[model samples]
Target: MRGTLVATGVVVVIALGYVLSCIIRPFRDCWVCDGKAHHRSKRNPKLSRPCRWCRSTGKRLRIGRRAWNRVRRVQRDA
Candidate 1:
């Protein structure tokens, strides 16, 4: 009985991960700035500022997916 529950839990986790992987795009526009060059500040110090990660371009890439794509491209080229 305990073993069955463990197995079921594992399956459910795998299924959820699969669904998330499919739903979340590998690369997408930055949600925080909405593709804008700057992001609004949430604190009292400043009202807004340029994004550091996207360099204000508002484009963001998933690290894992980007690496996966590079690997596949290299393999295909080879």
Candidate 2:
């Protein structure tokens, strides 16, 4: 039973790792500022700017299912 529990935990960890690896963007906009670091100027203290890269969505890019499958196919063929 202990071994089974360990195996389940390992599987869960692996799945979580895979999911995390799929995240291309770990933040929104510049990722360095959380969309606010760049505007930290004394001249402009009220800049509510959004990140151009993530469009203010604090999520990473995810591989589309079809594109992932296509890459997998190429790798398998190789």
Task: List lDDT for all candidates, in order.
Answer: 0.76, 0.58
Residue 22, candidate 1: alpha-carbon lDDT: 41
What TM-score do all the candidates reach, one by one? Answer: 0.42, 0.33
lDDT of 2: 0.58
What are the candidates' C-alpha RMSDs? 4.7, 6.9
Least accurate 10 contiguous residues by lDDT in model 2: 24-33
Assess the local accuracy of residue 73 in candidate 2 as a C-alpha lDDT between 0 and 100. Answer: 100
lDDT of 2 by residue, 1-78 (tens): 999999999999987876665564333334545544343445777755554555555443344433576798999999
Model 2 ranges with Cα > 4 A deviation: 25-78
| Candidate 1 C-alpha error for residue 7, in Å | 7.4
